[model samples]
Structure formats: structure tokens, C-alpha cells
Target: MGALTIKNVCKSYGPTDVLKGVNIDIQAGEFLILVGPSGCGKSTLLNMIAGLDGITSGEIQIDGRVVNNLPPKDRDIAMVFQSYALYPNMDIRRNISFGLEIRKVPKSEQDRIVNEVSSMLQIDQLLDRKPSQLSGGQRQRVAMGRALARKPALYLFDEPLSNLDAKLRVDMRTEIKMLHQRLKTTIVYVTHDQIEAMTLADKIAVMKGGIVQQFGSPRQLYDEPANMFVAGFMGSPSMNFIPCKVVSMGNETGVEIDGGAGTFKLPVRSNQLKSSEGQEVMLGIRPEKVTHKIESHLENSDFHLAKCRVSINEPTGPDTNIFIHMNGAKVVCRSTPDSAKDPGEEMEMMFDLSKMVFFDPKTEERLA
Candidate 1:
């Protein structure tokens, strides 16, 4: 049996519908991520599962038992929010064991559990101090410690690292991943951060406008997106979509791209060109797939090579980000820092067409 099952769950407030027939089945010990932009209902769905908000329709089952009508306190779940939410007056030890105290757990047992959790989170020294005496990262760990103390069947995390600084956020992300590995407890995390979702989730559900856009592993979503929204949303620099036309070159059918230097035809074996020939289509390429000619590790036959002027160059430590124009659309290339030329200089580039994606211009659905 699945750990948690949400069957056709829907939520609405007054005239506004926040969730539209959302459905998901999470396996026991799976790290599930709900990721999307604001007002996309990721948090609202998490809240419904936590029983902090009511479900307008459908049922939620935990361990094969209906939990839709249960109160938050009755659910065997722990939640950690963006804000640490540690008690102001209570020391870390008290805050960590507060939930146990309310449930009438024995005093000696609570102390043992708090010590184990605090030690695991590496915050044992801070256990004697109040929240005001701890750093932001330490406090965040304490918040996690509080949740970890319960050893609950389910954990719901709502943007837990959003409040921390960038550097701290990175550190905490690793810590959370390690903690999950050690505990092997089921977790449903909500975040808009693509890196977090990609790194931590066993299964990712991308939401948009109160609907699920796609649900799959990170590689599946990147390689075969359901639509343009998902293709553009999952990557760092985002996928570049270039408008092109399918034209016939002698007896062969191919896609034409205006590379500024000249019009080049790229063969399309995956997308049947019978009906699409002489029609407009979209070409989607990721930044990493674009590269400088000299720095390209692939052989000449591996990718489609072209020459274009560098419109911009952004060096980000490990790799240089180069921008160029193709068919009136801006394209980004990830190249070695040493091989990047100055802006306005003409440079040879290779577009790795093997990994390239084709889409229907009208529907924005993948054609290849």
C-alpha cells in the first residue's frame, strides 16, 4: 500500500478555485517535491495534506486509512515552515520536545529523544540557549530537530530554507538530504527552487495555475517535457525557443534556422516532415547544449556547427555564459571560461542537435 494517497483532491475558496482535481500517490519513504511559481497551489496542496486546510472535494488516505476529516493534531505528521517558528522564550531543548510534552510523553523519554535529535542535527550546544541566541542556520536546524524528534510517518516542509541567506541555503539543502537518507521517512516538500527539487525529490510534481503540469523524475522532465511551460520552467537559464520553418531540400525534408551568417537546414528524422514541411516550428535548446567551437569536446559529426557574433559574455566561475542571436531570438551558450571571446566578436559555435528538442509552434507541444 502507498504511504499517502490523494484521490481527485480539489480545493476552492468562495469563487476562486485553488486546486483542480489534484491526484498523487506517494510510496513509503519517498521524498516528493511540489514545485512551481507563486499562486500555483503547491503550498495549498501541502496544507490540505497536513489537515491545516479543508479539502472541498475528494479524499486523503494515510497508511490506507481516510484522513480527510481528521484534525491536524490527529495526523501522524510533522511540518517545518520557512520561518523557524521556534518559541521565543523557550530554550532549544524545550522547543524541540514541546510536541512530545503536549502529547504527555514521559519526561525522561522526551529528554532522550531531544538529545538524539539535537545531536543528529549538530545543534546540541545550542540546546541550552533560546532562539534569540542562535544563528539563522542553527535555528533552522532546531526547527528540523523539533520535527525529527517525533519520528512521524510523514513530514511536510514548506520552503524551509527560503529565509536563510544564499550560502546558508546551500548548506542546509545538503543537510536536509543527508537527514532524509538517514531517517528514510516520507516527506512532501514544497519549494519554487528548481535546484532543490531536482536534487532532493524522488518524484517531482510541477504545478501551474492550480494544476499539475508534469510529474516525473528530474531527467524525464528535462529530456521529455509535457509542454512548453514545463520545458521552460525546470532549467536554470531556461530553454531557448527559436522559431523556424520546415522546408524541403531536394528530396529530403529538414528544419531551417536563420543563423545570421546563413540559412541552414537541420534534418529531422524523429519528426515526420510530410504534413509539417513548409510550416513553422519551434526549436528548444538548453544553455549547456550550446557551446563555443574551440571549446566543444564533441567531434564535428556529433553536433550542428555554426558561426555567430557574441552579443554578450557572462563568466560564472566554472563556465562562461555566451549569448548570441539566432533567427531573431536570443540564445545562451555555456562555454569554457578560457575560450570565451569578448562581446561583439564573431565566434564559431556548435549546437548539439542530438539533444535538441522540436515543438509545435501552435500548441507548444514537443514534436521530437
Candidate 2:
């Protein structure tokens, strides 16, 4: 089994702590991503798992075996770094087989492993080329090939795609996903890109200020974020936050939003809203949730139409982002390109309140 468990992990340099009581567990073959902005201690935590850095406190287990004090070489793990740490002078074949050579693996076995890895990574034709002769993407594949040759219990990738261009990065992401499916090896990957985390991870741990803010399946974090920070950070356009006062309209609880054209009351039913009557709260809604009116949604009791003056319209191929002022804050609404209006034009927009989320204005925590 390739399962991994980290318990109460902490890291410190002198008096300053880098990781503070972080914990995570993953079953064999699970793809876990450590994602956050720079200096969030994701790489630091990854290093500790790989035995590259000494842990200040906590236990790391691999397949139920404690590896806290073990050295990297003894941990039965392989790492791929962002810099593509390939030997400049060594040919691809030598680079892929070097680890096996040191492990005293038989020459015949080493040759077989090299051939298999090179073929798996689709780099067999470039085996004779040196690191300098390969492109950025090619070199990355070679790096992965070297790790695959080891057949380790765990694979650690530290922002491995950060060095490649946008197109190559996307292409490589697909390749890596396919590799994980075929190998079924436990992987702990660190990346600051939220898109990568959403696309590649079976589970994601979002970190900030050396603490994990949230950890779950990507859809869980996207659909039900722990707080405003997570809701805003995980999406491309980011969820829109509008500060409004909660009020009661008939038997339904709702919030009032004042667009430039008129005031609209959107009925909402959430635990937070029940107790927050007449109190100010942040209403959270994703851009796609706020769109042009659809006939089917008109029958929903929580659906309402409002008129707003478009402040800006940005066409993004398949859809257009319409910016409008609501509750004195700029809010983005995604609409079909054909239905989008020009700037300063008054347009009718639909607000779907069924999926709206509420957060405490002071604590910034999800209230529902």
C-alpha cells in the first residue's frame, strides 16, 4: 500500500514557524495537491514528507510505516522539482538509469527499467540526447521518467509544471493525469495554481499563512467553500461578494440589493440568514450563477429579475462577463455572448438565490 498520513506536522526555523499543526491522510493511489500562494509552507511540508527537511514536530507515515527520521534516500520516495533537476552532462538514458545504477540494480534490470520508463513517457527517441538538447517539456518528461524508473512507494512533485509555457503546461497536465491513472501510485503534488489543483487533484488542501484553510474534493471546496477567502480564491473570475442587509419579506428571509436601476429583494433560506435579520452580511454568488433570465428559472420561488446598468462588458469567447453595481459594490455576471449588452446600457439580469451563500461580515466565515 502507498497510503500516507501526516499528523500534527509542524516546521520551524529558529523562533518562526512555517507549518502549524497541519494534518492530512490519503489512501493508496490518491492524488493529493497542496495548493496555495507563495510562502504558504506547501513546499516546506512536501520536503518534510520526502525527508529532505527535518520536521520540528509530528509524525509522517508511509503505508503505515513511520518515516520521520529517515533520510530521503531511505524513504522509498522519488521527487520531481520545478527546476527539472536533470544532470546537464548526462544523456537521457544515463539520467533515467543513474538511480538504479547506485542502488546496485543489475545491469540487465536497469536497462529494462530505462526502456520501459522512456517508452511510458514517450521519450524513447530522445534517450541519447543530453539535457541541453531537450525542450522544457521534454526535459520535464525525462525528469518524470527518471522518477518512474525508481518505482517508489510515493511520488512528490513540487510545482513541476511551473517552468513550462501555458500551452505546454496544459498538455503536460493531461499527460501527468494519465500517468497517475496507469501507475496508480500515491502522489503528493504542490502547486500554487488553483486551476491545476481543481483539475488534477483527487483531493486538495488549500493553505495560507502556513495553515491549511480547507481540505476536500475540488467540487466541495468550489461549491461550498469554508470562508470568503476560499470562495474567492478557487474560481477563475472568483465569486462575487456583495455587502447587503438581511431582511424578511413575507415568510421568506432575504437580502435587499440596490442596483443602479432599482431595488430588488432576493429570497434566501440559510441558517445564517435566519438569525441575521436586519444585520449586514456578505452575499456570495459565483459569476455563472448570475446570468440572463431563463424561462425555466422563472417558476422558481427564489429566482428574481432585476434591471441594472452595465458598467463594463468583456467577451471571453463563449461567454461575456457583465459588470454591474449592486449594493454599492461591483458585481460580475456571466451571460451568453449573444445576450450581453454594451456598457451604460440597461439590461435585465436574473439572480438565482437557491445556490447563494452567506458569510459573516466581521469573521468572514461561511454562515450557512
Model 2 scores what on Cα lDDT? Answer: 0.92
- Model 1 off-target regions past 4 Å? 249-253, 272-274, 294-302
lDDT of 2 by residue, 236-276 (tens): 99999999999998887889998788888888866557867
- Quote the positional error of residue 203 for candidate 1 in Å: 1.2
Clashing pairs in 1: none
Query: What local distance difference test score does each model get?
Result: 0.88, 0.92
Q: Give the TM-score of candidate 2.
A: 0.97
For candidate 1, which ten residues in a row score worst on lDDT? Answer: 293-302
TM-score of each: 0.94, 0.97
